[model samples]
Target: MCGVDQLRVGLVGGGPWARNVHGPGLAAHPATEITAVWTRRPEVAGELAAEFGGRACDRLDDLLDDVDVVAFAVPPQVQGPLAVRAAAAGRHLICEKPLAGSVEDARAVVTAVQRAGVHSSMVLTLRHSPAVREWLAGLPSAPAGPDTVASARWLSGALLGGPYSASSWRIEHGALLDLSPHVIDLLEAAVGPVASVGWAHHDEPDLWRYGLVHEGGARSTVTMSMRLPIDPTETEFAVFGPGTPHRLAGRTADASTCYAALLDELVAAVAGTGPTPALGVERGLRLQELIEQVRATAG
Candidate 1:
């Protein structure tokens, strides 16, 4: 439980995404405050703390003692153990996707959170994306009508050269492992739970494709890559089955807005007044299973 006015959040990880997205996003959220920051790098933590009106904490345990909630921006491997520690402390969690480096680690997080009864929210951007939300709301509940099949592509040049190029995990894991959590989560939301993986492949270095069978008999294809040397990028999520096709079009709100919405949902879930559907550590475990299956198939 948090204070009536706002939640005091202790931020972890001072990476590029944390600096650019998470730092500003928490600052901009009216109901949350970054009360403390802890990063592996002391100087980077200090910089973020100064920029976000938080205290720089050298020890994660000290930061945990000071906050009502913990928000993680680190890689999955780092996120797991720290999240378990936070859960044991009865602190709520806002975590990055993929939950952990391995399925076993991810399951540990889920178990800890469930045992502690703390609210947990995974940072699945599309779960909070306005455009995606609109598209999802417009979808058929049962995937029974025409044009119900869906497909998505998240091709990006993140590894070619950009701020994210420095991300070692993203570079090593490739697109399917790095980016497919959001894609799979979104597709499952639009259709139903993924009944099984129809097929998956590492198309080439950095490129991957997957076929998914939804619980409702609807099917989807997802393709992604971070190695493509493209000027801009290519991304789309559209559905087509029996009727007219529906493509995710129109101007989408920026990531900050989506992050803010995620915080809002986290607040609601913590308050026990909102739906917790597919946005927690449990969902992260499910995504990890999907990733493992893909990896095994790829290998």
Candidate 2:
């Protein structure tokens, strides 16, 4: 039985990410308990709930009714409307990136959360990694100006053959929707808010290259793809300024570790013991807007 102080979490997916990260993270966190689980596939949900010592819910509403918060590990399109419903029901939210498939849907989610006065947090996983925190901490704090510029590249063979390759939404949308949120969010945090998409390009096999102009005149270039022939994904972020360049390379931490950190902060915010997380639904909406701009520019 969960303690009175533990936040009851309803997990809303049955896929690998949910099974591997969300279930394990919530069950392990002292401040949270996986009280209910729901997914399109009831059998899979049952399996997950059984593994985590939670009950599988046959309907979304049943899950919502049984828990204080909703943790989503589903695709962005599936997540948006459901998130709005969860917010309307007065449950706090832990949302996935991109928020929704389109800017309109993402905005709807933001509006719903605002209207309901519910606390929400985005699953910007990299932002929670200790190495990423240290990297951002070492960068210049002042708003970046013309003298500062940054670059990022995330190349992976994920779509070539893997569990994620089976994800229809990821295959359709490619790296821009699946990966740019993490990169853009990190760059924006390291420098300043992105003011405009200077240019954008996409090619066959999921390659994306884009330029962004940040507020205060700083600029950034990004290159991403999920069909590359690389073994381990190649990721690097660097800022070149007045002094020596600062760089963050390779993986920071496993997904579960970062997610646990996210849960720690989110549970605190929901309990009124901590400030609202900076990476919330509003931030997700902003990132979605930027992604749309990139797509439009590419066309």
Candidate 3:
């Protein structure tokens, strides 16, 4: 229900994910105008800004002068205070996934957004396929409960060969915190609040797995990594729903598909114009907290 003319937003972070997905998707939306981008790389931001007709601001402070929203595309470590900075300026948020590497930071983000009475959504919903969305939509309108799943896989391999440079933060940060949150949020969305299993541990240097109990009393296993062979259906979806089996194939890493859809949803949510996919800030924070726990266990 968003009108053609609504909010004027800005984006921070000049990374590939922001350039390829968040920045571009915001540009193409009816409700958002990426009016400024805060990135250190002035040249690149300038080019993208020119193409999108938004301004290029060197400092984050410059963005506050004109925008109604701030989309933080930086890494988890940098997102905490920046989120508060934006909220303090009275801007809504659309930060990227893995909001922060720890639960505390995520909670800080949640508090800032809540206190401001402003909407905030993370980008981990990036990998949610339309089939995944549709499947989740069909869940019976029963009271929230913990989900009991026999098994599940959180798969991705795009960073296998390394992205852009040989030094991949995706690998350095391990799997759980960086990549698995996408699936965690997806599962949490399907079920409900995912609670911790005490101080967890990371299973491998490259892999992160955790024990989670959803509100529905379902045991959930969250897995993630930067290592795997690329497959067309790598981001595929499958689920056992209350006694029936359903699988969705062909979830390619089409950057624009699901990422774009979620952007539209966020836009609508900000504009108070349409139904949102019921995103919970705690879900992301829990994933971050689990990541911290697993990492500490490995050390």
Candidate 4:
């Protein structure tokens, strides 16, 4: 890797997300190449390989043998075990989030990455959105003088009917597990760590809410759903404290743009000059722990 000019990447999973975002993003990056692709369906892998300028491989090991890193767009359950195998084979990782469906599975991914001493990143794309970044940076150190109350409301019709309608995991888990992590991670970043879940609730028809007590005494509320039927309002994060409220607008770019930035981070991390920060596997595990806490409290 010392004198390598391009990082060869093995892309796993050929779902809509892989085809739309991961494939396009990796293909667009100049510092890396999608050198191989392997999926549960060989035809799908072959299609993506042809479209993205990579070779299709019949086996994971064959793909592994041809690349320096592996980027996964598989479901949470599949992503977990495969990630472990990839890390064990000494491949760097670009994993999608809610790293695994269960805490135990998520922990295994963390251990594998650590033992392999590989650079890894989780696709927490919101952290790379320019609009989101501007808002985060504009906030003061104590963000509204130590008495901040933040709230995020993300309403969507993804489960009701959209590109994600076919996602079985999202259908089974619903909004809490699938969508809450995105909102929670952003809220936690803007405020502080979620020290405790004061209250959490999910009613029928896709309404979910949480009262999160952040460290340093700041409090935050999160509400999200994939069943909202109306034309959704802009996803907003608002904070109110000693002064006028401050709000951060959601991303303006498409998903591919967001993922491209994430890929850039992965490239830099592999190059040994970038810090993975909140996008790393450990942060992903912590998010999984938070998800379990919210679930336990909601139940």
RMSD per candidate (Å) reads: 1.9, 1.1, 3.5, 1.9
Q: Which TM-score value belongs to model 4?
A: 0.95
lDDT per residue, candidate 2, 1-299, as tens digits?
A: 24878988999998888888888889999989999999999999999999986799999999999988999999999999999999999999999887997899999999999999988989999999999999888888846999999999999999999889999999999999999999999999988999999999999889999999999789999999999999899999999998789999998867988998898888888888998888999999999999999999999
Q: Count clashing pairs, candidate 3.
A: 8
Query: On residues 1-299, what C-alpha lDDT tens digit does candidate 4 reach at each position?
Result: 41356889899999888989889888888887898999989999999999997899999999989989999998899989999999999999988888986899999999999999998888887888877777778775543334789999888777887678799898888888777778888888788888889998988777888898887789998888887884553577888776667887654446777887887787777777877544788888989899889889999
Over the stretch 185-219, how does candidate 1's per-residue lDDT look in tens digits? 87888778888888888866688988888877888
lDDT per residue as tens, model 3, 115-193: 8877776666544556666776775442234444523465556555545324345556656656666666665665565
TM-score of 1: 0.94
lDDT agreement of model 4 with the native: 0.84
What's the residue-level lDDT of 212 in candidate 4? 88
Candidate 2 residue 9 C-alpha distance from true site, Å:
0.5
> Using Cα atoms with residue i matched to residue i, what is each candidate's TM-score against the true structure?
0.94, 0.98, 0.83, 0.95
Give the poorly placed runs of model 4, Cα more than 4 Å off: 1-4, 142-146, 232-234, 250-253
Candidate 4 lDDT for residue 155: 82
Top model number, TM-score: 2
Name the runs in model 3 displaced over 4 angstroms. Answer: 1-4, 126-128, 139-147, 162-168, 198-205, 230-238, 248-254, 275-277, 293-299
Which candidate, 2 or 4, would have the higher lDDT against the true structure?
Answer: 2
Clashes of each: 7, 0, 8, 0
